[model samples]
Target: MNAHDPIRRCILLGERAPRESLIRLALSPDGAVFPDVRAKAPGRGAWIGVTRAELESAIAKGKLKAALARAFKTGPIAIPDDLPDMIAAALERAVLDRLGLEARTGNLLTGAEKIEAAARSGKLHLLLHAADAGTDGNRKLDQAWRVGKDEEGSDLRGLALPVPRTILAVALGRQNVVHIGLTERDAARRVSETLTRWLHFIGSHPALPTCETVSQGASALQIIPTGAGNSVADDDTCEELE
Candidate 1:
């Protein structure tokens, strides 16, 4: 964890974790619960580090309601039936917004040729592919990234997002955004932070095979490539680029 990331305890799990890694649920004056993804909302808030499935289970079992009551010290906290969907939507919006911001700043590069050149020249800080991207194209770019990072024999590869090319293109205001590369370190880190949090909340699935968000550091960011059904640990400590 970064030294600056404040630690907060999850009301549902009672486990302490970095605030950035957790989602904050703000309590309204009318006793309603809503997701505060950016954590910018004012007033009393409770943090949760559990995944959507876990959260739904807690809600069904009345565990989340009891925890909220204890945390807020209030009565009749109204838990919405669609709280899980709301949280997922909020997280997805956050990720898309981050990408759009980066695109506007000219930190993102598109087109297979451009990304391949950046990767081969070691200028790419992060690489991403749309969910429906072709396997051959993905492998080609993955090879380029490895060559640039001097890890030709290793398993370092670009992340595959859950969304398709159409969604990514719309978010970045581009055409056919099948692949994307971040040229700046800070831009990559910022995108990765939001992406990681979103991914962690949704939890890994077979659709997101061999994918992960970038890690913050002086060197190139590292993402652990895994096969389908493999899982990445839910932690903020991004692995070094060595």
Candidate 2:
């Protein structure tokens, strides 16, 4: 765990972990259970330090309901039967929202040329590739990032986001967005953390084979391709690429 990530206790596992590593569940006044992917919801929240599969297993065995009841110290709370799907949707929205915010704030660079230029300049803190991005395109940008440097004077290693091109293009309000490079570490960290949580929530990370490996059949690539999901519709809040 990084020293910066706050430590929180998982009510179910009773283990201490980074706050960002745990999923937060909030309780409504009516005793409804809500997954707080951003951890921004109000009221007392319970933390869980389990992966998506573990969470689903717990829910299936009726263990999660008991754990939540214990954590909230209340009578049986209403947990939606489709709680996993709901949480997955919430996580997707949070990631897209963060991407949109980053684009609006000029902290994100899209398009192959712009992103590759930034990567080569050693100004890029993170590199995101759409799940459907062609292997050639991904390779070029990954090479640029390999030759780049971080702000701390260390070699930069590019990390691929699990989001698809459709979602990425919609989120950034750009046409055919296949690549994104984050210029600031803080912004990159925020996006990475959110993406990691989403991937974990969906049971995609550290378990399933990445899209890159499946597509290229080459172990040389460093990208971990994300699994497919429903597309997020475009919104007026996203600014068009200039």
Candidate 3:
């Protein structure tokens, strides 16, 4: 992170972190709390860096209400019982929307052949797989990425998204988007930022396949080297075929 990167404090966690890394909760005129994943809502907002389970627990114990009441300076803050789910859904949408934008710009590559070529050429900045993509397919592409990066013996691999191929296809307006390779550095950074926040918020959802979990295969995608000019990776434009 740059020395001038904006920072915010998480109300529940009481820890300072990069503003974009935390989830923002915007308040309606009636003091209803809503997810502001894009951070574009024009109003006072509170931030939280807790996971879904932690948020749910806070709500059950009335901690979140108290925190919001304090943050919004209101006696009664309206928090929906489904606030955690709402946040998760909003974050998920943000990730998919980003991928769509990147896809439209032609900054990414799909299809096993194309991705593998980019990976082998060391031009692939970020690699990702649909949750339901075949394991053998993912491994093949991951090995190509590692080989390109010259980390042949390492565990570097593509991320297995929490959503399946059907959802990915709809998001990118393509069919059977089993894997993706972002070729632009900026594009990779942007996508990685969005994906990181979503994964951090959701923690370990069951939809993520164990074999492709970040801890298992894609840990290298979590943080880009500071010298690489970004703290995370994933953004770019790409037109997907098939």
TM-score for each candidate, following the candidate numbering: 0.84, 0.77, 0.84
**Highest lDDT model number:** 1
Cα lDDT, all candidates: 0.77, 0.67, 0.75
lDDT of 2 by residue, 1-242 (tens): 33343455566666555566667788878898888867777756787767667788998898888877766777669998888888888888988899999999999999899988987897777787888888889878877876665333333334456667888889989888888888877787677667666776666653211221111122111221122221211221111111
The segments of candidate 3 whose C-alpha lies over 4 angstroms from its true place after superposition are 205-242
Two-way lDDT contest, 2 vs 3, winner: 3
Better of 2 and 3 by TM-score: 3
Ten consecutive residues with minimal summed lDDT in candidate 1?
216-225
* Collision pairs in model 2: none
Per model, state how many residue pairs clash.
Answer: 0, 0, 22
Question: Comparing candidate 1 with candidate 2, which one achieves the higher TM-score?
Answer: 1
Model 1 residue runs over 4 Å out of place are: 205-242
| Model 2 alpha-carbon drift over 4 Å, by segment | 1-5, 150-160, 206-242
Q: What is the lDDT of candidate 1?
A: 0.77
